[model samples]
Target: LLVALGSGGPGAPSPSGGAGAGGKLRGSRTEQSDDQRRKVNSRERRRMHHLNQALDGLREVMPYSQGPAVRKLSKIATLLLARNYILTLSSSLQEMRRLLSDVRERHKKRGSYSLVFFGSELHGEM
Candidate 1:
């Protein structure tokens, strides 16, 4: 026989048909459920904490101002700014490499190495 103790919610089955044992079983299940919920909540909190820490680290390495008067960047802004900064640096490196290659080619053509002025060349003067 099965008997519910309080609100007829998940009562245990017993061969001798007793409400006391069924109530204890239900209570145990409820406690286990609560404990599981607490564990999940704790894990979620830790995950968020770690994520925020990583974002803060990214902010530190970025080129944005970190003055006291300056407001902190939002998560989205920080990510976008970092991405753009990387792109700019990449472009500058590529330009430098191209300039070096041109200088090398010019050196090969002249046979005699001469002092090459890159100041005007960088500004569109050949």
Candidate 2:
């Protein structure tokens, strides 16, 4: 495999010389061992495959619609939707808890509103 390291035109040296517009040595390709290049390519492919897999997993669990007929959300959209979903769930839970607490407080107040004081003495469970 040809692996060059420099600025060149179309991975090739100019007819005049290897120097570029600035008269600097544009570039030259150094032949790399086939085995080494193959290994590097394989590693890059595998890394990208793994990244795609992770994104797919995230898409599967996201709140947005996911089906063969439906288009999957982009990376940014998926993240945003997930965040919104979590926030919505959190708000709903908080509202439910507040309502429950209010009910309990009302119940407590109902029973404790009738307090009797007898000669510098307080008689009330609340």
Candidate 3:
């Protein structure tokens, strides 16, 4: 009639506790580890809650919210998407700069700018 859920302590019915049905319930209530376990579990849950809140905050600033019902992005997806967004912005800036340079060169002088390939001479103007 004894029960031990945690601490792996063997539950042995005590003859002095009166041979009654309530003896089994009292054995589990007497373990101090149960309170400690509850405290540990509460801390873990709070930590996880904070982690999820951080993820949700990250999702709020992402650029991919085009769908009618956008779902929360996974951690990997968020990271990948952010990486791609930065790459796209960098490439766009590079292309715009290249175009601006081309325009300025064309306005200043005709056929003044030349593109040279690596390990080879300029066969013709780019």
Compute each candidate's TM-score over C-alphas: 0.63, 0.48, 0.44
Q: What ranges in model 3 sit over 4 Å off? A: 1-54, 110-126
Q: How close is candidate 3 to the true structure, as a TM-score?
A: 0.44
- Which digits, one per residue and each the tens of the lDDT, describe model 3 over residues 8-126? 23443444442344335655544556788889999999999998887777677778843578876887788788788889999999997898677657745664444443456443343
lDDT of 2 by residue, 4-119 (tens): 54445553554544444555553333233556788899999999899878878888887655877879787787778888988999999999789756755775876653323233
How far is each candidate from the true structure, as Cα RMSD in Å? 8.2, 12.4, 10.7
The runs of at least 3 residues in candidate 1 whose Cα sits more than 4 Å from the true structure, single-residue gaps closed, are: 1-26, 112-126
Q: lDDT score of model 1?
A: 0.72
Using TM-score, rank the candidates from best to worst.
Answer: 1, 2, 3
Winner of 2 and 3 under TM-score? 2
Q: Write the per-residue lDDT of candidate 1 for residues 54-112, one digit (tens) a residue.
A: 98999888876477777889989988998999999999999988987787678767664
TM-score of candidate 1 to 2 decimals: 0.63
Candidates' C-alpha lDDT: 0.72, 0.67, 0.66
Positional deviation of residue 12's Cα in model 2 after best superposition, in angstroms: 11
Clashes of each: 0, 0, 0
